[model samples]
Target: MAKSTLTPELAARFASIALGHVRREYPNKPDHTLAGPQDAQTPSQLHPVFYGSYDWHSCVHSYWMLARLLRLFPDLPVAADIRALFDEQFVAEKIAVECAYLAAPTARGFKRPYGWGWLLKLAEELALHDDRRWSERLRPLAEIFAQRFRDFLPLATYPVRVGTHFNTAFGLRMAMDYAVVTDDRDLAALLGETGRRWYGADADCPAWGEPSGDDFQSSALIEAECMRRLLPAEEFLPWFDRFLPRIAQREPATLFRPATVTDRSDGKIAHLDGLNLSRAWCWRSIASALPECDARRAIAEETADRHLAAGMPRIAGDYMGEHWLASFAVLALEA
Candidate 1:
């Protein structure tokens, strides 16, 4: 099958998927911490602006997708609906409540690096639309998350190399986009240094633990993707050659194949679908940074197409995957 690329039609479809649930607060799986009897608040009450799409982080990235689609396809039929949703949710008062929740002692680790990263990514997308005021309203909340990264990275002696939300590489990967777009030299420098500290010496990654049962990411690929985004091509290309030295032959065969999703209805199992999409995104991105005529570029791009073919069709099958899969799909298709 040919590789799927983002088209106006697909963007509209993706936009509709997000718009349908960005406000559908049901079937929620909140990552809340109740400090006391009075702290038992509903998802919407706790996060006025980000209380939909199953969880805070999913909602955050859904918004990011909508914003990006709006920018990419401004004449899309759903563009007005996207604008309306942004007008309703991106208000200063609602964002203040989100900030207040973060300030709570019981909420120190709420969403941690994953949600934090997505929120910053949303802010970065919004900032690109100079005609809109959403980015300005969301700036305060974005700053808090930025500061969290600033405060946490220094104390993070070791990186979490998991394939899930707590993976420090994924967090830095998403957040670095915001830092660079905003010209935040301090945050950018900190993120670059931290990435080197965590992954600089990595060579010949065995990828022995990929597709862990509940994983939505390929830990090895994402770490490489993170480094690609952080380092200059001159430096990153050498590291990439060292890290995945057998990519030309696809030696770590697991990285080249798409994961199987046995049951889309099972949320944990459904993560395998996301794993495929994210891997495609990583592969496409990694390939982009390689020299165009390099053999590994063709190999990586072919692998990415295979992964996308596996995961793209399953994005809307079940609510288990629906609430967030579209975002990963967008990442893969757009990449």
Candidate 2:
């Protein structure tokens, strides 16, 4: 029998772990790139809406995870806690503060595409509910990032095909979600055009080089995820075939194996766990996009299981990993 994935019990567990960190503001690690001494501020002081969960993007995606859990399992024990957090923070005034920070001269590219993408993803999750109130409340902030996407993608000539935060494919994949529910044809068109430009010609990927010590994503897999979204089913299949042509032979052995985290106490190094989870999610997506008769489909599904098995065990061992692993676990389990 197949190992169970995405059970309601597991979702609730993941939700509880995420809630613990989303509002824990201490021992904060802000990614503020200060322009001068005058720009100094606490994480919470700088980002009123998103200053917890170790870093800005992690905080943003933790909210995304909770919103996703509540949407999938409304009876979750932490449902009210999730809603209350939203009520307290996702407000006009707080969002205004966030936007103001973005507008600062020192903040020109603050968070750039990665944090920006997760913010849009959180908005996308809120948009999925029957209640449009959260979506309405988040629209102004979402629009800000949406415009950033519009302005940035055109100038970004090459894709950042890394396994780290700056990976171009991961950002676009998240942004595409926001584009769909919001019915932003302009954003969708821009995404389609840019995705094709950056990745459409990708073929015979040599997945041998993977999982740099601090990587939290699989560059190969996330690129696959992005291409699957941007192209039609018929087109995606042929592209996927050439891109991962040796899946049947497992030629890219690195893609089949999960990364090892040497130290969870070291924050950057702990990203290996997230890399596994991200790969699992990507593998599941790749599997779903392939035809049933395709041998790669089974390979994708099995590799997904292996990656999930490796990562799920380490989700809560240390603060370094726990601060954000649940969100990636949710991403994988949901996929």
**Candidate with best TM-score:** 1
Model 1 lDDT, full chain set:
0.93
- lDDT digits (tens) for residues 24-99 of candidate 2: 8988877777878867888888888888898888899988988898899899888998888888988888888898
Question: In model 2, which regions exceed 4 Å deviation?
Answer: none
Error of 1 at 225 (Å): 0.2
In model 1, where do residues sit more than 4 Å from their true spots?
A: none
Total backbone clashes of candidate 2, pairs 3 or more residues apart or in separate chains: 0
The per-model lDDT (C-alpha) reads 0.93, 0.87
Per-model TM-score on C-alpha atoms:
0.99, 0.97
How many steric overlaps are in each model, in order? 0, 0
